[model samples]
Target: MKYLGIDFGIKRVGLAVSDETGKMVFPLKTIHRSTRENLFLELLNIVEQKGIEAIVLGLPLRPDGEKSLTCRQAENFMHSLGRRTSLPIYTVNEAYTSLEAEEILSGKGIRGKKQKESLDQAAAMIILESFLECIPYERGLK
Candidate 1:
């Protein structure tokens, strides 16, 4: 099954997708959040275009695991997205994913504005990877 991973932000949203086998993940693209409706439409289009079967959404949490305002916003986004799509949606804690993404980018010699532009997509990849690690994959089905 193909999966879509999302790292939601107030200003920008990051996206990633898993291969048909669900063993390999790739950074898709970053969508600038100009408006909620526009973002949702674009996401829906990607889901249809990519044959995405499920969604893994990153839910921001405080370091201590408490829900913050951003977490609430993520939940709201999840709810809105759920209403729009019938596909299953799952949330995973996204603590430090951005920092991890930055480190990965820095290792690749990406910095400054370039790094900032790609950070969310990299983070989404991390979030999706974490989810893939937890799920049990069968031989014939992903």
Candidate 2:
């Protein structure tokens, strides 16, 4: 089954996807929060086109491993997304995924604000990849 991964943020949401085998994850796009309604429509289109069966959302938690205001916000967003799609939604702890993305990009010589924007999508890719690694492929099938 194919899966969509969301890295939710205040200003943008990064997207990543897994292949049919659910073994490979790839960065897809970033949707600006200001245009999220449109973003949802676009994502719906992708779901239909790609035969997506599930969604994996990155749940941001505080450093102490507690849910924060930001985590609540992400939860609300996930609930809304669930209402809009028939696919099953799942969450994974996403602490420091963005920092990891930044480090990876920096090592590759990427710099500045532009790199930060790309990091958003990169982080989503990392989140999805990790989530994919943890779950057995057979379990993903409904």
Candidate 3:
């Protein structure tokens, strides 16, 4: 099933999408936070337009795997998002995804403040990529 992966933040939400086969996840775009209604409506538009069958939210947990304040906030956001869309939503542990993204971009010489700004997209990609790796089909059914 096609899936939309979201890296949610208070200020901006990074988005990614999986192909129908769910083998690859591609960075879509980032959306600035808005009124609850507006955010949900916009996301719904993308879901419908893209034929998204499911949603995966990235949960920013602490390094030791503990839920932090941000985790609670993400839980609330996920609940609200599900309420608005009535679609199945899943979450993947997002510890260090941002840092990992930063390291990757830095390796490519994406430097300075610009690299920081790209973290959201990179984190979203990491989140989706991790989930992608777990799929049996994607990993040769191993």
Candidate 4:
């Protein structure tokens, strides 16, 4: 089943998608949040257009695994998204995904504004990859 991975932020949201086999993932794009309603509408459109079967959303937890304000925000986003779509939604703890993303960008020599623009997308990829590792493709089929 194809899956959509999301790294939610207050200002910008990152998206990634898995192939039909769910073995490979790729960064899709980042959506700039203008309004909550518009963000949901755009996400819904992507869900339909991509034929996404499930959603994996990054839950931003503190390094110590405590829920922060951002974590609560992510939870709210998850609930709101669940209400909008019938697909199953899953959450992965996104503790250092952003830092990891930054490292990746730095290695690729993507710096400054350009790196900032792509940081979320890379984070989304990491979040999706983490989920994929936890549940292998064959296991996910059942």
Worst 10 residues of 4 by lDDT: 133-142
Per-residue accuracy of model 3 over 17-109 as CA lDDT, tens digit each:
999998888888888887777778888999999999988889988878889988898899899887788778988999888789889999999
lDDT of 2 by residue, 27-139 (tens): 88888866768777887898888788999899988888899887898899888888899899989989899999999999998889878778888989988988888787547
Using alpha carbons, what is the TM-score of model 1?
Answer: 0.94
lDDT of 4: 0.94
Q: Give candidate 3 regions above 4 Å deviation.
A: 137-140
Q: In model 1, state the lDDT of residue 79.
A: 99
Task: Locate the minimum summed-lDDT window of 10 residues in model 2.
Answer: 133-142
Quote model 4's TM-score.
Answer: 0.94
Question: For residues 96-136, could you state the per-residue lDDT of candidate 1 as single tens digits?
Answer: 89999999999999999999999999999999999988887
Clash totals, every prediction = 0, 0, 0, 0
The models' CA-based lDDT, in order, is 0.96, 0.87, 0.86, 0.94
Clashing pairs in 2: none
- Residue pairs whose backbone atoms clash in candidate 3: none
Best of the candidates, lDDT: 1
Clash number for model 4? 0
Clashes of 3: 0
